[model samples]
Target: MADKAVDALSENEARDELARLSDLLARANRAYHAEDAPDISDADYDRLKRRNAEIEARFAHLKRQDSPSEQVGAAPAEGFSKVRHAVRMMSLSNAFDDEDIDDFDASIRRYLGLSDSDPLRYTGEPKIDGLSLSLRYEHGRLIQAATRGDGSEGENVTANARTIADIPDTLSGAPEVLEVRGEVYMSHADFADLNARQSARGGKTFANPRNAAAGSLRQLDANITRDRPLRFFAYSWGELTAPLAETQVQAIARLKDLGFQTNPLTSLCDGPEQMLAHYRQIEKQRATLGYDIDGVVYKVNDLGFQARLGFRSTTPRWAIAHKFPAELAWTRLESIDIQVGRTGALSPVARLTPVTVGGVVVSNATLHNEDYIAGRDSEGNEIREGKDIRVGDWVQVYRAGDVIPKVADVDLGKRPKDAKPFEFPTTCPECGSDAIREEGDAVRRCSGGMICPAQAIEKLKHLVSRAAFDIEGLGAKQVEQFYTDGWVKEPADIFDLKEKFGSGIQQLKNREGWGEKSANNLFDAIDERRSIALGRVIFALGIRHVGESASNLLARHYGTWSVFESAMLEAAPMEGPAWDDLLSIDGVGKVMAQSLVSAMNQEAERASIDRLVAHLNIQEAERPATDGSPVAGKTVVFTGTLEKMSRAEAKARAESLGAKVSGSVSKKTDIVVAGPGAGSKEKKAQELGLTVLDEDGWLELIGG
Candidate 1:
């Protein structure tokens, strides 16, 4: 039987769908925002979010705390210092078609209690397809710049922002305290040039202009950003000490006057018809535009009206992004290939007959997973009307500004008579190890561990990735070559390259791609990274769930490599004070902790880590400077209802003061703030003889 529509779904079905959407959207946000790599197309992501919203609207009680409707973006990536936005940076809700646009206008009018004849104007501006940046100016001088990370906090990129020519370092006649919010993008010509240069130098190339812009702006080194041709378009404001103008269009004009690059095509539309007409005009000119714009954003023209309309949890009600439709093409599925990631995930790729989608020729598209190919989602809901994909079948491919194309639908009428359902592999394709799909997991993973060449090579590549060791001239290609040639099998083998192959009959200089100068440069780069920070070292290990941010959190919590190593070794059995302490670190969950422990306690992995450590000097993790703050370096736990503030507000405040907010109570917990309805956690805190405070007490302690 076909699944019911979202409105017709039962309470249980709605709850299950909500859970599935939440997980998928969370992964999508992390890939797009934190990693600068989008796993799904914009259209598919928007569709899932729309379905999630419809279900939530029908069954409000089934709405999850971590609903897609409530999240803005992923948490900020590691390596850069974080900045908390004075005013939250909100995302815009999307409108796919003309009907959605009409409904949007009508809903705004209804909410404001206005008639069709009411003079409600809107400002339509191109929505730049790039990274969102917030530039803060104090006394007409740029003081800080940050990426829009998780809405509330962002990564500090002031140095990189200073290098962009379009972003003025000093603005004349600007507000004393102004935060200009805009999009940082790369022009078409610049993007092509950058890719050419990257390809020539054997460096990683970007998939699109947006990724190029995001990667360039988020660089750890400012000089790299300075060389990249990045542009900015100021379309909004945040935390202004004084209003720029009474209306949106006037405010944009004022921004342009203040030496900011405001979008030239921004116009004031009298009504929905005019707004949509302007959208169509912009769409027609999209091909000629020098930069990339995914859509047009429409906002209420009157500043007062916008304030009255107010904001939702993650988006503003006054604005919506009228997105362009995804480009689609029909192609034949030539074959299905399984590729293993560093984490051993068996991702399926559909090799397709060459076809043009959105002006780009695509020969491969993402199958997502076996379940996706089987025409069902993780919750067993049918997708593409339960049409299973097969080799040699005609498929509809879609491209929505994504790096990879996606198989949107399969045409059963064109299916070949001999077509057969794809059988997912039961063993690793590279190492022949048993591949297992654990309960609740969509992708199957290889059990070969270090022995699997695919996983091993990918892990080695990840060890030297930009966010990890970041060795110059040692990218994915070089890592793969070294691994295949038996020159490097593990992290420790990399350090031994200079000593073992520096001067011998089989020398690095004798390699096909290496000269004396280049070989020495590689050695120097490897040597320079011998004394890396603890966070980078942890990230380079390539633990299953320990990403850059999680690695940094672990490094900060443990302080030193020896301490972290010892704790993980002790926590391997999954019980005891060490395990409890590991679990007590903020953002460290049972799954992450288990992964860390498994990697650290496994005999072969431990030996490899020991060998790697023997050849390097690891620095202690830097602690945030809190000076005289009472909660600095303390671990706090909040339980029950907080009357003074929301739980999120309390956690943010605590973290700002250099405190860790753990989700659970343990003996290592420094304090527990209890409120009405506090039960087990309160009792546990008392039992452990930890400091217990009420909501008022917490406020008093924090100097409210």
Candidate 2:
């Protein structure tokens, strides 16, 4: 949105913007930090976050608990087990120039009551563009390694971290239990070679060394990581049983002596001036460093001084990252294309004239949506004063935060005389279905449903996803090929592949990429999942608005497919007692109920479900035992806070005891667990004379 419009937003507009910003920022954090594949440029992220903060400051009462300001990054991605860190791996506050560095020094000295002549030593080193890793050593043996996921807990990447040659398997003359923290990086040469190999193999190549390092380190297959040229540099320690040295520089030296790599450019700077000088030197040598370095990190050299400096909520006071400027270059806008996602949302992508940005060839950039291409907001407000982009126009592309090539600026005077505004497609490019835009929605979607080839292919991809059917030896490529070859067109066809090809003339084993052992393994994998969970079956259907959690809710509520299917069929008429009943279930909203009923009402969708059900025995969702419990089957609401357990734990416990946990207090609420700072729900419960209990009372009643 334009700056003037943003400032002039009404309260309702502010509320909507806050919600959009929260969701967008959360998704960006997950893509960048957890999955290591950022979807948006850093400039776009900063712009939205700054807007969110401004709105919150203007409207304090509308601030949400899960606001972007309170979060560091998202939780770890699925597949790996979680590991809680003993000490938080906090992010560093950033500084842009020598002035910011001076301000940082002044703030530190002011906090520590030190004079200008205190002679405090600081270490300045290049901040390697890579992924953060924490290696835990127990009894002088490397036991575990984890990613820095949301600071408190992380994904277990021990196997992948062990593949890097720099990380030793065993440590001699070390602490009984020590956790070493460092960066896992890929050098520029290694990155280039890896991209060259990826290009040759027609695999996805990374945009930068940092992404290559992160993607390499987070691999599920350790064999893939082992083949990548990955290295590590230990710069800090976490949860040490014994101290390595009295100072940060000394500890780094000790780590290097213990057969670990450390940044050779690290130097002890006497003050801020020396630090800035070192940063300048590193900035000058950034091009020839043979690895990516986005900035310089300055930390207090003395460990004791750092210990006394303490920490803010998200960053430490004794350290700061001085970031270098972004890389930018001008290129011509060749054309624009619309890419439809699995959910039917049509996204616009820019096809640019190939140009180098940060040593990576840039051929495309994200146009975000129709509004972005039109230089307008969803509300039709002009962004950048209604200056829309067109084909053959000169646009400046930049890498803002070490990743994602994006168009940052445009030269309006250089536009072609015959340049015309690009027209976003109103019909699905794949199936020519009418693309629709709902009220208050940002993007347009295809109305063709499964008939749209793009959406159908994506849904097929999701059918065998890890959280769903998870058929091994059958990945995206196999699924696509099977669909094209008419071997597997729907979820049910996956089960019929073996029967069709058992002794056929054209067998799957005879395919170009198939052999005996692999084909047999695939068949065995398919056979093993013949008896599936009801929740998995629901999730595998890929219905709109139905995720794993929602499927589980539906599962636990109905217990079996027969009951669930009957309820959906009854509710398919769209408004009656059955619709009310579906909405009465906790965690199920109107949108979800509508989606469930509508999906069941569709003839094609229901026919596919019938075929899938005929092939397997879908097990009922098992609920926790709640025998002889008075709260069993009661609708309850918990307000404020619980002292003994977290809110999530409390909700799970209540659900385990067969009590339905609702979000608000109502006439049907059987009980209200009100703690300190209880709000309107507690008052409503009191007005209705409902049973309201404290945390202790809840524990007593649950027999905890």
Candidate 3:
């Protein structure tokens, strides 16, 4: 059956569905990876993801290899030496609801040929969202700490790993050799402070704590990695030269004895029912857990049974990740402030008294918009239900992990007598220019664009970013100088730099750190960068809604710079059919379309674009489609718990090879490649008339 038959949606409708899918997945990605608080219900997100996969599978030709459906996990990053695991690391199948868990238990019993009366003990622990690394110690001295790469291969970050306070540099009275696997994460407070410092320095702040840890740990310079406040929680082990324990519980206990930090939440269950109870208990207490936990991980407690029911390509047959229902918490509302993003959108922020929840402090959150703050829901109550959260009012805070915090609810009973509703400003907070809230949207944006000083400075910096022009001598300082000297105002002014600075550039030779050779080298480097990739050029144009990934998407979609530019101009001004159709392209959005039109409508911006285009040559190598790739647009589902590679890696590899790796499957799924003890996804695929493949087929498709 076709995806069209499944929904009978028109092209526009299909595009809308895809856009919603993209936004949903991206938000989930941010929540799971950056902030930790997942906004959408897990079951709903899973359904959307499955539907996305079905759509992509039905229309494989329209699918990008990098689609979010295929981006289930990330690959092990560079800067570390690679090491293959003795036993492959696999990820666990997940359950978002009690029914799902029940189904999972039923499947497990059936797979093991166990009667319902037979017992199966499980150990449940918090599932930490962080970088997964396997640490090896010889005679109790830490030797290596490698990321859970492609199960077999991972990069070594030994030096950086040693800096983690919880990881013992040496263990006393331990096994001759032990390979313990755990997660490396940044505490919520550390992440907040890091983002604050980055903001103060006018640098980009990370979206969440996990990203901060991931970015920090993957630093090329070990010293940089050392500066990060990283913590670890040992959950499982890979190998031990000597027997560490007779059971899984004892193995974890031994790991703790070897100076590893272990979660105290671990509990033994008599069977899947007890395991499910433990999962619920953890979910209820998730807000109090100091670290971010999206779900509870349950593993078979008996080592003998574990050995008998071993692993698949990327997951174990005996473990599952049972996710918690998304919840929102309440906090006191201190004040509301507006922030200007790089794109000049004025975002509303709520400040609150410091409170600790889920192992992190919460002092601020996103209010989203003035409408959100001032408007009301179906009931005759304020939109956020607390008279727009005036200063001193009590408000609710919610998160799944270290996410951009948001006020989930409010308590009017706790409001102070003197507290009054906040009056959102009509002018840009940064530039005093009149801000406009476009029809059909909540965001209030500054129409000033490059004319706004703050926006202008940020734009200049963006124009010369490494991915953009790659000008060696024209760094932020140089650009600032040029701006101050009135030698450069717009991006096009960069081309006239040589004529204006020809003599002054020679004077650069006399600067304390500059030599004639160095000065000339900088000029040559700038000249070399005059020609760049078409994607970079598109990105450098600073079109709103067009980010690095979107630029790449558009570049691949349009092929040529001329065609892309023409499309933009033609797409501008047109609102209904033409605009919607063009913007409906997978990566482009209405926000992006409006920005392009607004930018192009201005004569100054148009002139700058024409000037820059005439003076520069941008080219790109054609990327031919890899039709021969077996994994092309295939749907992959990772089940059970993995030991070698993190669940993220398995998903990333499948995607990089042109597969659509979704959390679940529907009728549109071309094939469902499942790991051990497949869960709801496998059953759904079967129900939807989809074919199922095993781990061996997955490996063959991925060319492993």
TM-score of each: 0.71, 0.70, 0.56
Q: Which stretches of candidate 3 lie over 4 Å from their true place?
A: 1-125, 129-158, 162-182, 185-275, 280-294, 298-334, 356-359, 377-386, 399-404, 411-418, 457-489, 492-531, 566-603, 614-616, 624-704
Residue 464 in candidate 1, Cα distance off native in Å: 1.0
Q: Which stretches of candidate 1 lie over 4 Å from their true place?
A: 1-40, 45-124, 130-232, 236-251, 264-292, 296-328, 357-361, 377-385, 503-506, 510-513, 686-689
lDDT for 249 in candidate 1 is 93
**Alpha-carbon local distance difference test for all models:** 0.86, 0.81, 0.68
Q: What's the residue-level lDDT of 608 in candidate 3?
A: 81
Lowest lDDT 10-mer window, candidate 2? 60-69
lDDT: the better of candidates 2 and 3: 2
Q: Lowest lDDT 10-mer window, candidate 3?
A: 1-10
| lDDT score, candidate 1, position 659 | 94
Task: Please give the clash total of every predicted structure, in order.
Answer: 0, 0, 29
TM-score of 1: 0.71
Best candidate (score: TM-score):
1
Q: Model 3, 1-704: lDDT tens per residue?
A: 01123355444444444544554465455444323344433444554566776676665434432345544323343234556677555656566677876776676676666788888778889989787888888887888888765455666788888878888888898878888888998877788888898889897676567777877877778887787888999998887788777788998998887778999999998876788788888878865665577888878787877776665434677787886655466777877888775466676778778766554556766665675676453222455433566888777776544443566666878889999878888888777898886643335678787777667766887788644675766766777766776777888888766666776466566656667787677767767877778888877887654555666666765678788777777777767545654554543555456766677666888888899888787786345365788767555556655433446557666666765555445444677766666788778777887777776766665677
Q: Candidate 1, residues 1-704: lDDT per residue as tens digits?
A: 01247766766556656655665676688789988987677877887798888887897655654578878887777678789999999999999899998999998897788999999999999999999999999999999999999899899999999999999999999989999999999999999999999999999987778989999999999999999999999999999999999999999999999999999899999988999999999999999998888899999999999987777768998999999988888999999999887778787889989776675456877787788899987668888888999999999988776545789899999999999999999999999999998766666889998899998998898788755787877877899889989989999999999788756224777888888888888888899999999999998998865666678888888999999999998898899989988877766656567878999988998899899999889999998888888999888999999876667668878988899888888767899999999999999999999999999999899898
Give the candidate order by descending lDDT: 1, 2, 3
